[model samples]
Target: MALAAAAFTAGCGGGAPRLASYVSPQFGYTIPHPAAWHRVETDGGRRVWFLPQAPPAAQPPEQTAVDFLVVMTRDDPGPLPEIDVRRLAMSLLPMHGVSGFQRAPRGNEEIAWYRFELTGATGGREWASVGLLVTGPKRLHYVVCAGALERWRTAQKVCDEVLRGFVPGDLSR
Candidate 1:
């Protein structure tokens, strides 16, 4: 409900980004993302969009895509239930390596995180995850992350813009 933007090292350059407004009423939120980027829906029917991870290549469909999590549940009020969102994420990745993520820093409204690459074929994959963790009513914590190599340096601006654009709606009311 406030203007607390997420911070991370996902790279993209241009003027202030205006993300497209989310249409589905399921998410109950919307924000401005950069124009031109395409929103690719996943097979399971979860709303997904491109985060501009890599330059367009002639083949291989762009090794990866920086995507956002559930759209409707953007403002999850939790004492965080026994939800296995992490396990669900792991099942999506190629059946090769595992990721060991850890808490790196904590701020008043923002908690920065880091991911340790445990076993993977891709080189330099550790990421710092910056997201909003809603503790309860009016208590939302923003977080940011990136590859351990250049965590803060690379994600400074993009993290700010994305997190600031976060919006949530009241479902129970």
Candidate 2:
């Protein structure tokens, strides 16, 4: 894949970040992510990592993660003979409370992916998100990477890199 590395200017005035690869044997997938983001554990065996737009204050709050990437796996219900890209997009629309929902193209042949944008209802926040749906040998995989829409112009490159570098592993093991 032609995943060009475009220069990214941090919205928080931080320097350009170095990327690192995260490999999960259990989930059977590999993805490159920003080295600065902290990996946090969420429910349902899901892996979530996030980085705040700005540096933390002297006294950080309960949580600081803002922009994030999430990867999870589920059992594949076989091929989708009834679903096309548009129909799949419609079925996976962002949940309520996220307005201005729209889908774009994302991912590769092994992985059916889609891009979406939305405005948060509370603060009118803008977000850019990408979803990757992988039909693994024994299971299905989904990955999402999202960031502030204001930073998307520069962040899109990194997001693309993550998707392109993502390698699907054997979940049936």
Candidate 3:
């Protein structure tokens, strides 16, 4: 988590770039991502997917250095649970094979949003990542933004933009 935060801040001193909207008709949600990123549908369009544009001259152009996903969850009764970002971040360590896991210091405190950071092996390589968990009135939303540790610095701004711009839909409709 420390590594991911450092990478996020290192190259993200300037303001975030423009974003493009991604809306889901079934779920009625809308989120923004970097305009340069490409969208690819999967799971028969049940899920939303976006991949960051690799920097010029990157060794493997096809390598998904950074990616984002918006996932919808089942409806539940009662009030939403207060998500402990620190505990939540630590909980992912075992599942992601993360050796060092920590939650970044909180920067924003939205009523429905929680953020986390982690490092783990993916595709035989180490990745530094961040994720946002959001709760809507009728359902839960999860957004994961991750990139290779080496290139995460360059990808952080886009990740932040996407997470911050997320707007969940009106599930009651």
Candidate 4:
């Protein structure tokens, strides 16, 4: 299944690039990303980062551009209610300097998930991001897709595609 997922690619016409699926056996989740993106995993698969193929040439050598998608998972004490999940998502906003925050709830009665769209400035650079927080039976999953403000349109497209393809692991396990 991993090999098949790795081999599968979806082409987008009119100059749009193709994408490939990244399946993490350790985490039991899958995310779609551009073929050229660089992937990094840490904390025993608790966190994963995906960066562009290369930093922009105009970027200062000392300051690498902060554009990437990150997925993080942590063990929760137990199941949490929708209100708690929403509060948790709201709490994360300030930490990221997030503004223009908008939230949308997802999932059925068994799972509590919240999605947020926000714009923020960090290190003097403006950026935009889409964040998702989900509460499972025993764990919480968070995914953040962000990019530079100037390139937000293109970034948002990729972010949308990534979100659409994201499949969380079986939290009941």
Candidate 5:
């Protein structure tokens, strides 16, 4: 598979890190992430996680300032109702303290896709996430990028970049 290089700057202003594409051979989807981040896969490639490197020692270990992205897919049983789709998306998120739910502008008319943003408290830490659910012909692609609310503005930029670059389905094959 061919991986394209892209430049991404996290936070306000600093040197941009080069990004590399990650193609899921098993699932047939691809996304780009900063080269410095670590990748972890589980559930036989059904779920993938992109985690940033360890934080500086100056940061308190207990300070749950987390930033990461997770991509997951499951078999889709054809198209679903709008309410059902919204329900499915909400079910994937934290059960409590969720708000600011709004559907993102649509793109790609062929497949049923929903993009949204929400904030919620999980594990006593507030987080902001941008999530996408694409009901493809054969699979339901769910991608979410989240970060601590304290740094949400910066994290949202990176999350948007990752979400925009995401392409569902196996394009490499």
Candidate 6:
């Protein structure tokens, strides 16, 4: 975990362009990622995915599982609507080897989520990923899950930990 935190500090605090404070944020929250993961800053924003060298077994050995990609905008008004999200999701299916997608909701949020079932090479054959659209006080959360199929479903508790931790940074801070 130490390595993971170090990676985040180095990756997010280093000489990247200073991002202007988000304006009128709603769910603008930040979670101090645990020490075992790495912060992957994408064109969208900062992301945290598993360390490349971490063994696959390090994740829960289940049929399907949850991974995270939380995004906070410079301004958090709210999440995009379902129609837009669904369209956006469909756009990504082709990129991640997804054959197709079915739109759905994630709790109270209007999200167009889908799952991908593929083969896992390490004797696990069920692979799935879920796309979620979350609106908060200062950020829009997107959780794209990747894991073994059935196992991911059962790992809801694990994923909830990620969801429940969302907290808006002080607008004053």
Give the number of the best model, judged by TM-score. 5
Give the number of colliding residue pairs in candidate 3: 0
* lDDT of the candidates, in the order given: 0.35, 0.51, 0.53, 0.64, 0.66, 0.37
- lDDT string for model 2 (42-160, tens) is 44455444443332555221133225566666666532222443354334324233333233244344434433433221124445665565553356555666655666666666676
How would the candidate models be sorted by TM-score, starting from the highest? 5, 4, 2, 3, 1, 6
lDDT of 6 by residue, 1-173 (tens): 33322322233453211122222233345543333443444334433343312335545222112233334233334355555545554453223344434443433343223332322322334445444444433444444434334445533333344434443344222
Name model 6 segments beyond 4 Å from true: 1-28, 32-34, 44-79, 93-126, 129-131, 135-139, 168-173
- Candidate 4: worst 10 consecutive residues by lDDT? 1-10
List the lowest-lDDT window of 10 residues for candidate 2. Answer: 1-10
Over the stretch 15-101, how does candidate 4's per-residue lDDT look in tens digits? 334777888787687888777667776567777777654544565311443566777887874457656765665554333454433
The reply for model 3, stretches above 4 Å from the true place, is: 1-18, 53-66, 69-79, 83-111, 171-173
Put down candidate 3 lDDT per residue, 3-73, tens digits, no spaces: 33343333325345457788887777788865656566545565466654332353322233333343433
CA error at residue 50 for candidate 1, angstroms: 3.0
Against the true structure, candidate 4 reaches a TM-score of: 0.73
Per-residue lDDT of 161 in model 3: 72
lDDT of 2: 0.51
What's the TM-score of every candidate structure?
0.44, 0.62, 0.60, 0.73, 0.75, 0.42
Per-residue lDDT of candidate 5, residues 79-136 (tens digit): 4556777787777656343454444455444467678786766558777788788775
Q: In model 1, where do residues sit more than 4 Å from their true spots?
A: 1-18, 53-63, 66-124, 135-154
Q: What clash pairs does model 5 have?
A: 28-169, 28-170
Which structure is stronger by TM-score: 1 or 3? 3
Worst 10 residues of 3 by lDDT: 102-111
Pick by TM-score: 1 or 5, better one:
5
- Give the CA lDDT, 0 to 100, for residue 120 in model 3: 59
TM-score of 1: 0.44
